[model samples]
Target chain A: MLLIPCPYCGLRDESEFVYGGPARALPDMDAQTPEAQHSLYRPINPRGPLRELWYHSGGCECWITLTRNTITHEFEDDLS
Target chain B: MGYSALSLMGHAFRGNTQWPTLIAAPDMRTIYDIVIIGGGGHGLATAHYLAKIYGLTNIAVCEAGWIGGGNTARNTTIVRSDYLLNGSFALKHFALKLWEDLTQDLDFNIMYEPRGYIDLAHSDGELEQFELRANAMRLRGADAQILDRSALKARIPLLSLDMDKRFPVSGALFQPAGGVVRHDAVAWGFARKASQAGIHIFQNCPVTGFDISDGVLQGVQTAKGHITCKQALISVAGESSAVAGLAGINLPLNSINVQACVTEPVKPALDAVVNYNVGLSYLSQTAKGEFVLGGATDGYASFARRGSFERIEDVLARAVQMFPFLSRLRLMRHWSGTADITADGNAIVGQTPVSGLMINSGWGYAGFKATPAVGHQLAELLATGILPDLIAPFALDRFALGAEQDDAGIGPYPWLH
Candidate 1:
């Protein structure tokens, strides 16, 4: 079974988290410029450290965001 | 495209469209540009769209059995357009509208009653979820209303409202567009309309071999004769994998057997369909007063399509739990149909790896209600040689593209859900 560390609900079994793959970065609501902020919000299909979003549907009712190594599943931080 | 195997052969035993039988028919002069396997609701619906909508008359629906003999005839017959997602608008709403206007369109009484459907809630969490669903549907321009315990109790007085009662029916999400129809009539109208459009509806002809040349469909070989075709549509839900395999094509379908049973005739008790996510059971009273019920799948994915007595009992038990009065009603008959279970529990439509092959299977069990929209989009794809945006994500390629619609908020229904 795949084990995942959900940012919101903490580290849990994969079944507890709905696999959301890579997290899509959203621009800040109060970004100074639409074009300048859009650069930081561009979708990245990175082959390295990736921010993944997961829904802790089976355990906690929250959408978790985490930055993790895609190949290794080693997450840097958990943000529930 | 109306394919009613029941109405085509007058409800006779189904036949297979084996490769050998299709070669021998005396009427070999007609060579269609596109040939569809299975003359069920999907096939017929496709035929109608191809001819009337797309003006593509070079189509043949080869059926080994009569039309609608497959799942089209065996479905629970509950039609609903209330969905929890935005992607389902085309099929859900389009099909519901077509179902509402079906009788008038076909000049045939499909017995379509706009009695609507209700999703019962037994807990607070369930109520919140139902509200979300109702709200989502409303936002999508669908006619949906969330009923509180009092409102639901007033609408369905016979429903169990007492807290201590077994599986208390507390609140319900009502969808006025949800209702029942004469399944056979749907098949009949499509078949008649498709036939009039010059679509060759070949009965007792099985397509066992697909003649693919240079990775493109050359034609199909059957038992009776061979019909050269430029393209082919495999809409056979239950037998989708086998049909795809015959063409040397791979479809991501895990076939399973889903069962539905009917109870002895009684006065109409439940005005609308009531179901829950936990049990994956749906029960509705037919126009003839028979309780048509669907239960969770009994077995995992397999080739067998047999219904066990245990599942029938399970279905009856759930029905009884919902309305205890159903316990007295005798089980009249039960039937099992094949479900081409997909990973996401949605259909796989549009182009496949094969050059000239289009797939419209993997419906799980939502085929009956989404027939019209599926047909419309599929025909457009076939005629224009492009996947319509409506069912594009339903493609098998979506998994590889990493854009799969993995989350369909409908909490467990039957099959893969």
Candidate 2:
């Protein structure tokens, strides 16, 4: 089990939160381009350290961003 | 020596010492007509058909580990073709037809049992949805029967059909043709047949990079030595994105760990594969009487071939709910496999941006059921340089064309599927 440390809720179990996928800049909300489709469909997934979004759904309900290793499932100390 | 009653009796009388090896270790060459990147069942099957059907003898299958040590040996081994979509049902049914004659075709026992599959519904709404899906399946030339509560009880005698329970027995969708197969035998069978056809099988040989220039055919760089080939097929299931990345090709794939567990041996209790659909958990008893249970993927993207306890607990809870007597049994083993999921739940086959590179991946946790079909179609693609019509719908350009085969109706959520 992953022990995700939320910025507001401190540390919580993985079941207490929901995964928000790899953290990347969202395309313009109103832009209707092929890039929007690419952004929505082709996520920046890698087998190394990646910044991702997580929702503390079972706790503070705050969406948090953290850099975690995708293979190791370990979180870095710095949270943005 | 061919496997038969005479061969078995001869071996038994001779103290089992005269049996020859299934496949011999052959010398690897510096160049081949084609090199399959992963030596899993799909890759080996592709080689087998390439040599058998297409009459291409120069082929090499490079494995990062031992053959059949990956998801080919980890899945619960359920094969079914009752799909709501036309493409999925057709492709899967074609594979099922091949499976009927697979043991004879390969001259290896695969233990393909047609024990039927039942998907239980817990409510009226769910039953209605199953009925609609059943109608769609029947329209596509597959067998799907809707069984009410009483019929389900007669089929599965051990099931708890009490109405006051948490998940009451509403009804089920039964497909008599769906069943299980011995997973490991598939890879070994394909490898033996392909090796017999003079195809090279390399173990512990990993492809580190690709040799591509001017956007045309070249070769692959491996750990042992660089091997040149006329074409390359990327069929690595979990590492589809990672391996394709080496060729500077980006695939819309996310790898997640899907887990399955088996209980200690017990007397034969379950006769058919049962899916408690409300909980998304399914189980079937092996010929040895051990119950194999599996559920949804671990709702996150990770390459680690292990899963969290919470998902296992949820699966066990539902398993016990359906079969109330399962509380006494102990779990024997629990393991996970990295599933290469796509934005749409369907697989991606056919050409890539590179000229000589092709891919047959994004299978997620359901690749085992489509092995023969993928192998046949990919072999044709490699030989003729044309995607078969059956698999053309699964092309990578479907995403840009807004023709994604979203069988689950889920939108762009890799983990959810």
Candidate 3:
């Protein structure tokens, strides 16, 4: 089980949080080129370290950023 | 020596020491007509077809490890063609036909069994969806039918079909021709045949880099040596992006871990493969009487060939719920394989932007069943330099043209797909 360290709360079980996928910045909606639309919809599915967003749905219900290695499952809490 | 009753008797009389090697160990040549990366089932099968069908003998299959060590040996070995999409349905149905004659054609035992397959539906809406999928499959000349509750119960007596219970089994999508095969044997059989046809099988040799000049691929630099080739085909399943990155090409693939587990051997109680679609869990009794089980891919993207305990627990919960007797069986082994998933829930095959370079990957969890068809199509593509009509829907340019094949209706999410 993954021990996700929520920013608002402390470390909790993975079931308590919902996976929000890779933490990608939204592209400008007004200038919706195919590339920008793809960036908003599709993922690059990186194999190395990834920045992801996690929602602490079971507890604080706050979103948190996690920098974790997709290959190793090692993570560092980014409270900032 | 050929495997026959006479050969076995002779070997027995001679103390069983005169058996021939399954495949030959040969040094990599400096150059070849074609080079295939990854010696898993797909790569070896591609080599076999290229040599036998296309009559291209100057070929080499490079692998990072021994043959069948990757996902080829790790999958749950379920083969079916009950897909809703046209491309996948056609490809898998073609593969099923090839699998029917694989052992005879390759002169090896692949343990191809056409028992049956059932996908349980829990709700009315899901049952309607299964009916639609069955219609689509039938249109493609694949065998698919909807089985009512009593029919499903009669087919598999052990299935829990209590209507009052939570998550009751309403009906199931039945495919009479779907079944399982010996996964490792498929790879070994292909490797042996391809080797006998004079194709080099290079084990423990990884492609380190690609030698490309002026938008054309010249050769590949490997750990053993740099071998030149006129054309190269990349069929590395989970490492699609990593290998393509060497040639400065980015693919829309993500590597994630999908897990499977097996229970201790028991009496053969289950005959048909049972898949609980709502739970995303599938289980089948192998010929050895062990229950082989598989579940959904990990929600998070990962390259690690291992699974999380949480996912395993989820699978166990669903398994026990569907088959109450499985709760007593202890799990003997559990493992994961890296699946190269695409955003569109379909494989990516055909030429990339670079000339003389082709890729056959992004199969996610569905590559095992499509092995033979992928080989046939890839060989045709390499020999003719024209994308066959069967595989045209899977081109890499589909993503750019907004023509994605999202069969699962999950939309552009690798993990969900």
Candidate 4:
């Protein structure tokens, strides 16, 4: 059980949150080009630490960003 | 030695001391006709077919660890061909047909138990959807039927019909030919056969980099030494993105962890594999009397092969709800595997952006069942350089062409798959 640190509501259980994938800027929703598909679908997923998004659905219901290790499951609540 | 009644008697007389090893770990060669990365079930099976069917002998299977150490040894070992999509159903059913002869073909027992599979539907709409899927599966020569409440009860006597008050049992999709196989035996069988065919099966040989020049793959750089090959197949399941990245190619893949567990051995009570489709939980009793259980993925991308406690709790809770007796059994083991999931919930096979390099990956949670067909088709593709119709729809560029094979209608979300 991951105690994800939600910025709005402090640390919460993983069941209280939904995992949004790798953190990236939103792409053009209307663009249908291959580049757009690559942007939306193909994410740069490293096996090491990286920034990701998590929705605090059961808590504050707010999206929070955090830098976490994919392999180790360690996290830092530095980012808001 | 070819295993037979004569060999068995001879071995028994010799106290089984003269039985040779299953496979050999040979020294890596400098060059080969083909190199298959990841000596899991898929890679070894491909090597076996490549040598036996295509008659290509100059091959080597490079494994990061020992054979069958990866997802090949981690899956729940459910084999079925009741997919809703035409292409997916065709590939799996073809694999199912191949599975029927796999024990004989590989000259080893894979423990292919066709003990039937049942998918429970909780609502009228889901039953209709299962009917559509049943028709699709039957069209592809797979035996599928829709069973109602009484039929499901009769098929699984231990199944509680109204256990979950929120979602009542409406019907189920039954596949008479679907069951489980011995997971480790699959990799071992392929490794033994491929090794006998003179394919080098190298253990602890991790491919560190790719030898590509001008968008053409020359070979691979391993921890032992650089091995040159004419053609290469990247069959690394969850590491598809990482390995392809070595060739400067980016694949639309995310490695997510999926988990399964088994209970302590008990008397054999369950006869068929039962899946509570509405709850997304499944279980099957092994010949050893252990109840193998599993549920959804962890719903995140991670390389950690450890599953979350939340998922374990949820799956067991659902399992106990369906079979009340399971609540009494204690869990014996639990583990997870990194699954290569694609956006559309379909596999990505065939050529990538890099020439002379192909991939057989993006099999999120269902690669174990498709081992034989993937081996056969990918061997054909590597030998002939032609995309077989069975896997052409799963090309890497399908997402761009609006040809996504989202069989579950879950849209383009890897986690949802």
Candidate 5:
């Protein structure tokens, strides 16, 4: 299991947390625009270092952003 | 000598020392009428169809590694068309039909076995969903039926029937035509045939970048050299995003790692492919008696072609739960492949926003089954410049138009899809 470093609860088991997907900033455009739709649906899925959001559902139940390497799965820092 | 009985006897009498190469190796040309950026199953099949059906011989298939080295050689090899969505149902069944006669058409034994498949349901709600899915498949002229506990047990007695267990087998959706095939043989067979038809198969040549001029794709810059082409098709499975990015075109795809494993060879214990829907594990015994199995994608997205130990442990727990006897069988080997999953579960096919650049990717876990149909439809799109009805529903513009076809019913999640 992944030893996820949650911002509120510190390190916890992966099962206790829910993956919130890639942490992308919401775009400031018309919701109907293709650019806006893509930003909302498409994922960057970067190969190297990634900043993603995770929810400590079983613990603090707060959304936490974590910068980690998707390839290595090593925890970098909690960006909450 | 031809592969006839007399030639075989003559060869045996002559000590059987000489043999001809199956396909010829040709050097890459500076230009081609069409360039297929991958030599995997789908890419090679696309070249085969383009040559045999569309009568287009001026084609080239480029591969960074050997043929079938990517997901084509790494998948679980299960072939079925029992999807709930209409588009998937159509495309997959078309592939199944093509697979039935692929050996005869290519003059190569791909070992396309029609041993059938069973998707187990562990609860009433799951069974109800299977009922709807099976009905939908049947309505689309695909073969699917719901098997009760007794029928399911009769088909595969090894499955655990204890309803009191954590995840019991209540019932299953059986597709009689679903089965497994030899994955690498499909790619090799297509490559051999396409090569014989005068299509160049370039190995160890990777497309490093695209040579686009004025927003139009002019050529591809490969590791060898730049090769101009009238049209280009990117059939690279997991590297769809990276390849498209070379042309400055972004696709609605995410590359994630999915893994599969196989057990040591033993006596045949399972006849049909068994899928535990609740546990997210699917398994089938190979013709050589090794049990090949796979689980769901990793929880997070990554381009690394390696799986985490946690996912493997979770999958093994579920596998042992479903098949108690499997606990004793030692795992022989395991490997992972990078799968390109889209926000919608369905694939993205057709011309991109840029002219002369076409794509046939975002297959995720379903690429092996959809290889034949993907090639046929993609060939049609490349040759005629018109999207075939079978693949029009999977256009790249669907995400922009907000007309996504999420077959898995999981919205906007690439890993889940």
Candidate 6:
């Protein structure tokens, strides 16, 4: 399980985590082309650093981006 | 490490080799070519491998409860091979490779996503320690990279890399081959395939005793009937020592109960599973959006599988610190399982004193991740009636020498053994 760093909660158990997939700076509402929205909604599952949303249900109950390695399940960053 | 080596251990690897000499004819009818004592994932996978790969058809999987309901399904569902030790190098990576190809191998959708996993360094001291881990992986041919504060932010823009922040993300050690899998699916998939391979699965049948009269295993005494088998494979996880007790041998094992919980479902949230190696806790969002969390196992081990509020409280404080988005989600269900913790955290594989009995036991926490390796190696043991080289070190005598296989040590935690 990934010990995600919640900005408000700190490092918590992965069970306390709620996976908020694909956190975007902005929702893709202003796409000029259909392909842009399609690409926005459907990202690839490649290996690398991924931006993830994790909730600290076991602690203060705040949401944050959990920079994670999909392969390692290790929390890279605790996005506040 | 196959059956031939059993002679050296004085039959500690295979319990009942000469079935005809030990069991009576009446009780022998229930016997199978291979009788697996635990219906957990390892047992089921072993059965599947023997039946599918080795064509060892006549096998029966006996479980104390519904199959796959043991420690096999009680984990946080995380899998990885990033370790800083040499002994753990082969075993952890073997499972990692198997996890990567599991979906195709099992012919079932395990939802295995090998995105990656990261380790946070909160202090310069911690960063120095992570460098050792990164170096270990490099020596073992595993990919691991150290990320600085700026590089960490570029990789993950939202991280609070500032040193001034509380619990700042000073740096990280990331490995892009670790991931998650549907724990139950691995069990079900193996069971389904094993059963189809002419292996009979008996549920709610607890093995009470081994019908051993004169230093030989005749068969097993269960609630239903006495099963006489030529070979027996025992994969009982939490109750491994309990099963061994039937043969009048006290195994050096501890049954530690671990508890975990899941939250009510919500919209899809987290993309990858995250963990804190120092805190000894982790949380990940399921595909259905429920938050699954677990921290330290119940402090001061007991046989009780039930959990306490203290452990939960510890996990919650850390959870909130990591991600503040969980205050809204309601805690739904919590469950527990007795995990068979060995003197060493590694598994104990090979034959036992009694003939015809082989064991796949003592996986402290990584049982779910090692399902494939256990199955594959166990099958080889069962077919040739011998122990495999891969699992040879995880034998019964390691306990006597005070050798513990405690890997999973990510940071510079104190040496447990």
The per-candidate TM-score of the B chain, in the order shown, comes to 0.89, 0.98, 0.98, 0.98, 0.97, 0.86
Residue B135 miss distance in model 6 (angstroms): 2.1
Candidates ranked by DockQ, best first? 4, 2, 3, 5, 1, 6
Residue range B305-367, candidate 1, lDDT tens digits: 564466676677766666778878787887777777665667778887778888888787778
lDDT of 2 by residue, B280-305 (tens): 88999999999999999987888889
The DockQ for candidate 1, computed on C-alphas, is 0.02
When summed lDDT is taken over every stretch of 10 residues in candidate 3 chain A, the lowest stretch is A35-44
Instruction: Report how closely model 6 matches the true complex, as a DockQ value.
Output: 0.01
Candidate 5 chain B, which ten residues in sequence have the lowest lDDT sum? B1-10
TM-score of each: 0.76, 0.97, 0.97, 0.97, 0.95, 0.73
The per-model DockQ list reads 0.02, 0.71, 0.62, 0.77, 0.60, 0.01
i-RMS for every candidate? 14.7, 1.2, 2.1, 1.1, 1.8, 20.0
- Candidate 6 overall Cα lDDT vs. reference? 0.69
Better of 3 and 6 by lDDT: 3
Query: Could you tell me the TM-score of chain A in candidate 3?
Result: 0.82
Could you tell me how far off, in angstroms, the CA of residue B273 lies in candidate 4 after the best superposition? Answer: 0.9
Worst 10 residues of 3 chain B by lDDT: B1-10
Worst 10 residues of 1 chain B by lDDT: B17-26
Better of 3 and 5 by TM-score: 3
* Stretches > 4 Å off in candidate 4: A29-32, A78-80
lDDT, candidate 3, at B252? 84
Q: For model 6, how does the per-residue alpha-carbon lDDT over A20-65 read when each residue is reduced to its tens digit?
A: 5445554466655544533432322223456755556678877766
Between candidates 1 and 4, the lDDT winner: 4
Q: Write the per-residue lDDT of candidate 1 for residues A1-80, one digit (tens) a residue.
A: 23567645556765565545445455667765655334332323332466666678898778877675533446677444
- Cα lDDT tens digits, model 4, B283-327, are 999999999998999987889999789999989988987888999
Task: Give per-residue CA lDDT, model 4, range A1-80, as digits (tens).
Answer: 88887777877899999888888777687865766876787666799887888888898988888888889888966536
